[model samples]
Target: MFNWNLIGSIILPNIGGWAGAITTAGQMKNENGTAWYQTLEKPSWNPPNWLFGPAWTVLYCGMGFASYLVWRDCGGFTKKSILPLVLYGGQLVLNWTWTPVFFRLHQIGLALIHIFLLDAAAAACTASFIAVNKNTAYFMVPYLAWLCFATTLNYSIWQLNKDDGENYK
Candidate 1:
């Protein structure tokens, strides 16, 4: 039989993982000259938007599982629990902030800065999680890879559309 309480404890954080991705996706919007992102000069390697959702979904689930393992391995709520949770939550919040800054506010340049910070936060968080649970750290590998791709994409976007200002305030 499965431990219902154990499963429940991790459920909220797992949902947060999903929520972070969905929140970002919800912020995307299209424009007249291009389909939101279609007008932007993406690198040749840019993956389609559809790929992002599924990828993030899987990654977040992995993250939740990793965190759960850490929580379980430790005394449920120790300094260890707080460490990974704080780091993970911090990065997740930063993750959620990127899309609004980029798409909603039309601030790709600012978003670039935000994404860079988000990347660093995730790295720091990953390292901290590793101290508590190696699997937790490993779960973030996909997130790290995606962030690297995103950093390039963000920089490219900022460069491609500089000075236009378009709808930007």
Candidate 2:
């Protein structure tokens, strides 16, 4: 028999993740040829722009599945499930917020701070997931690793362009 709840759980997070991506991409397009991101200095190790979509797709799916596992293990929104789900929800919001803060608002420093909070929230969420189901926590590992890498990249970008005060506008 099929588990529609599991499928729905997995699909919801992916929808949230992709919706943010689409919105941010639209905002980027509306820049009127300014291409502000291209003007910023990035670390040599920064991945090509083409990589982000695919990377985020995988990460979002993994996290969605992980959340479903946690939700299933705890038997829906009962008291036991509240903490982990709340942590997961908090981090997801932080995840969606970073792109606009960095790419649209051009607030790299603020984005860096936001990502640090995201890293902590994700780590806490993973730990909470482990308490419910250890195996499910594994699904979050790659996303956590990616968050670390992104934090480094955000920090590098901030350092490289902190002095370009006038260009931030």
Candidate 3:
């Protein structure tokens, strides 16, 4: 008989990741700060505001499923499995942190720092996932690529808004 428990086990973690992304994304200021983002000196090829949600939704789902695969392939919460999970969680935490610091507090500089760390964590997580499960590792590759782009964008905003010092204070 097919292991229904195994199937559900793999599915649940991805669902949890999606749920968390949705719950936390609720804190973003996409509509509230459209003017603020528009005023910034974004790249020539920067995507329209409407693109971010869809892109991130897909990426987060990939990360979530990758996470589940990594866990399952590594025999679930064992020593080998733990590292990837930790890295996954670390990247997710950093991902979740960026929105609040940038949109809510208006701390672009701090948000840039957060994004940089997030990029590093994501790369490491991808590496670990690849070591454990090729399919899972493949899934996170796009997310890592996007974060690399995002880090550059974050740096750009910090550079353009260098004069934002103490303005919100």
Best-matching candidate per TM-score = 2
Against the unseen true structure, what C-alpha lDDT does each candidate score? 0.73, 0.84, 0.73
Clashes of each: 1, 0, 0
lDDT of 1 by residue, 55-107 (tens): 76677666667767767887787875787778878987887677667765667
Q: Candidate 3, TM-score vs. the true structure?
A: 0.77
lDDT of 1 at 95: 78
Pairs that clash in candidate 1: 30-36
What is the lDDT, from 0 to 100, of the residue 69 in candidate 3?
82
Best candidate, lDDT-wise?
2
Question: What lDDT tens digits, residue by residue, belong to model 3 across residues 52-86?
Answer: 76787677767777887887788888998888889
Candidate 2 local lDDT, 1-169, one digit each (tens): 9888888877777776677687567544454764677677878998987798889888888888888888888988889999999999999888988888877687887898899999999999999998899887678999999999999998998888888995443
TM-score ranking of the models: 2, 1, 3
Candidate 2 at 145: error in angstroms? Answer: 0.5
